[model samples]
Target: MPEHSRQALSDYAVAHTTKPDSIFDDIARDAQTTPSAGMMSGRTVGYFLNTLVAITGAQRVLEIGTFVGYSALMMATALPEDGELITLDVSEEFTSIARKHWARHPDGHKIKLILGPATETLDTLEPQFDVVFIDADKDNYPEYYEKSLNLLSPKGIIVVDNVFQGGRVLQQDVPDDQRSASTRAVQRLNEIVQNDERVNNVMITERDGLLLIRRRDAHLA
Candidate 1:
């Protein structure tokens, strides 16, 4: 697509998509105060996650990253009254800010933030998550994907963010060794999901990239 055409469609999408509630707008603005504010999840990804929670009737959610809680709050808002979401992150600096925002939302009571490497923290939990969203360290995506499977419920779904690595996965001109770790890791993940017969997956072209997966026997697509 040409640059002007792309921008026009993007503008149309933005104009048609529902805006976040005023409270969420506040959280987004506060997220900008961080040095890595650009790392925050965009509106499209956030709304998609919220829809997933509602569609799955998910009572238990596990979030692998909690950058200022934009995504966490999105999912939390869609959860039922008795629903629970346990989000893992290693940065107290960011999660502290997340906590503040979560407190401002009514459904925020459903979220729990655990501070530690998710690789270690993931082991302590039971395999009961109805929905799992992974958006943490790029290099550790492979490890996270495996662990997420172990914790997933029979009818659960997995949503992965940044699967495209800003479209680096397709640069065949660059040798594997020379490419960045994130790019290489994302390539490997896409391959892993493609080859796995135990599940079915689709790569959504929204945002950076969103990979939605489910057990072959899962009720939802």
Candidate 2:
């Protein structure tokens, strides 16, 4: 499929699905004017995250990236009134924008922002998250996955973003560079999940790629 065609289909899908409210629209508009606009999860993926939280009745959610808090806001809305979402990011600048938007929503209070290196922050979290969404640095995906799995509840799910690494994962030869290193890390993480007997996993191609993993025992039960 051509890039334009794929994007058209994506746009059509978002148009037909349940639309996000004005608060979300406002955040998206603000994100578009920023240098890191592409980092936003957009409508399609945001809805998917919301649906996952709803289906799981996830009371405690852990988000690894929290870029502009778009995904966190969507998930936070899906949570029960007493639910909580802990989001970790390294940038104060990006999260400051997120905090502004979060303050507009009633459920915004459910979102907890922690600014620091995620690798260090991951260790400080309690092992109680019902859903874990990892969308942080690609090079640290393996470490994030390992820590996230330990933090998850027995019946929890882990959603990994950017698995396709901007289509580099499918290429036969990649130049040796920092980007290639990130691509290799994503590929290695996919392989690790594929071979792990403890979990059942599936990869879906959307904006980027999403790898959804669930504990094998929970999946079978």
Candidate whose lDDT is highest: 2
lDDT, candidate 2, residue 157?
A: 95
* Candidate 1, residue 24: how far the Cα is off, in Å: 1.3
Task: After superposing candidate 1 on the true structure, give the runs of residues whose Cα lies further than 4 Å from its correct spot.
Answer: 219-221
Which pairs clash inside model 1?
none
Shift of residue 107 alpha carbon in model 1, Å: 0.6
What is the alpha-carbon lDDT for the whole of candidate 2? 0.92
The collision pairs in model 2 are none
Instruction: Report the lDDT tens digits of candidate 1 across residue range 76-99.
Output: 999999999999999999998889
The C-alpha lDDT values of all candidates are: 0.90, 0.92
How many Å off is the CA of 15 in candidate 1? 2.3
